[model samples]
Target: MSEETVRSAKGRMGSFSFEGESAEGLLRIGEVTKSTGLTARTLRYWEEIGLISPIDHIENRERRYSGKVLERIDVIRRLQEVLGLSLAEVKAVLEQEDRLLEVVSRYRKDLDSGTRLVMLTEAKRANDEIVKRLDDRLSEIGRFRMERVERGQRIDSAIEQILREAND
Candidate 1:
């Protein structure tokens, strides 16, 4: 893809030209699905659930996603599949992360030590919540793994018994 910087009305560097199209690193639905291994219906459902959104392209009315949205999609996928978090849990974690970002931004702006302390405390609270959820999921996975291992051992013992009987 060709790269060209385009500035927004606010004089901020926003979009890049991809294939002669001046969109904000915007990609078509098909391209996103192909790259992310997600279906179009899944993307739509995510959008409906306030998880992710497509940019408004009034020209063709087609759904386009920016590069940042693509990264967010990856994050959502990892939270769900890797961390074994439900969609609701993922949403909660995402919201907490956003809150943490807000707190950090405010902390940067305010020079007062007391106010900074409050912001840091809030950030810690949000981080703790996220860590707690992850810990819970990890515990569940551990239990599941132990159960499977025990079952495998029992199966192996039964097979050994059957072999011994056949030899006798």
Candidate 2:
């Protein structure tokens, strides 16, 4: 059986089917770009780069995003705007985050308990990697912010001294 067929047997066939929301609430690329504040070209490029899964395409070749996947997009946006991570870093972080879902969906209780244990262990490892990456990124951001603050203060002090000298 094909991967899609096997996934369908497990009740989902795609990456975005969380809490049953992917079955409905789909948005076209236009709507997604508008709502996510991303350009259409950027979205397409991200998909092309494997940074994001390409959103669904219909018979006419227009693409629609799974609304459930909007949450994932938010994470991408935050990583882009806030953390300033490179595309490669963002992809690595996202892959780790998405790994648990992919692993857990493979579980079948009817199979040996050992299989379930393996899946659970894999999930934990993925979660740990995600957490570690996030923590490191946060610390890096903190240092960046402090450097910016120091620069601003220096600029302000220099301007204030010029004004004081001019008044005297």
Candidate 3:
């Protein structure tokens, strides 16, 4: 082949790429297979299993994948290869992960607000009890003082009567 014809054939076969024509992250099924090192059949099987979903569709009915799909693929790959988890177990784990995070967030909020309320209530109750006890003790002391004063008056009146009789 001539030099120019060979170069044109290579360019047609995607050997040479311009800036705008290169689809790196925005990949269709073939590119996704190449980038992920996964077979097209495996990708379709994973989709069938509900492990990952395509991000969008092209005008020609091609599925377009995004970075999110790539991340999910990585997770699925790890779960299968490294963790030795079955597809069902991986799906269940992912679902449980979301639920656990939600529950933890709610518990944290409840702990913060409920703990503050409980502490405030306990402190107020303690203060109220202390004030009530002090009031009762003060009232008892007042009654005891009044009774002693009345008894002293009676003794002084008796002494006065005795002195008047002596003088008469």
Candidate 4:
């Protein structure tokens, strides 16, 4: 059986359904680019850097992606443009989120308290890591704003001093 077939089998087992997306249901690379308003090269580059992966259409060797992948692309855009994260930082955040999702999935099935506690702890750690990265970025922005404000004040003071000297 193909990987897609195996993924479909797993999907029926209640796992995340990323792998089993049918070709007919999948969007071609051009369609994805049009839907997301991203260029083809950008999508390919993101895939190259491990930020995103489009499913391969085995017959024609074309790239395809699911709706969930489109949602993930939106998240990636927000992380980069809104959160001011570098690609590396965005990747880190995505990894932590993926880990948290896995932990949540396993926690739902495992009835043992000890195992649940461990999973909970891991989830917390992943959440904290994401928070830390955001906090660090925010702090950097705050410092930059302060520096710009201070420079503007200094420039204003110099201009005022020059006016006084000229008037005297």
> 38-89 in candidate 3: lDDT tens per residue?
9989888888787877665546776655445677788778766855567886
**Alpha-carbon TM-score of each model against the true structure:** 0.77, 0.66, 0.43, 0.82
- Deviation from native of the Cα of residue 138 in model 2, angstroms: 2.2
Best by TM-score: 4
Candidate 1 to native Cα RMSD, angstroms: 5.7
- Model 2: lowest-lDDT 10 consecutive positions: 1-10
Write down the lDDT of every candidate, Cα atoms only: 0.79, 0.74, 0.63, 0.81
RMSD vs true structure, all candidates: 5.7, 8.6, 31.3, 7.4
Please name the candidate that would achieve the greatest lDDT relative to the true structure.
4
The parts of candidate 4 lying over 4 Å away from their true place are 1-18, 22-25, 57-60
Candidate 3 residue-wise lDDT at 66: 49
Write candidate 2's Cα lDDT for 36-66 as tens digits: 7789999889888887664556567667566
**How many residue pairs clash (N, CA or C atoms closer than 3 angstroms) in each of the candidate models, in the order given?**
0, 0, 0, 0
What tens digits encode model 4's per-residue C-alpha lDDT throughout 1-168? 235533553444342233665544466676677677899999988888888887654656667676567778989999999878999989999999999999999999999999999999999999999999999999999999999999999999999999999999
Candidate 4's displacement at residue 145, Å, is 1.0
Error of 4 at 43 (Å): 0.8
For candidate 1, the TM-score is 0.77
User: In candidate 3, residue 98 scores what lDDT?
Assistant: 46
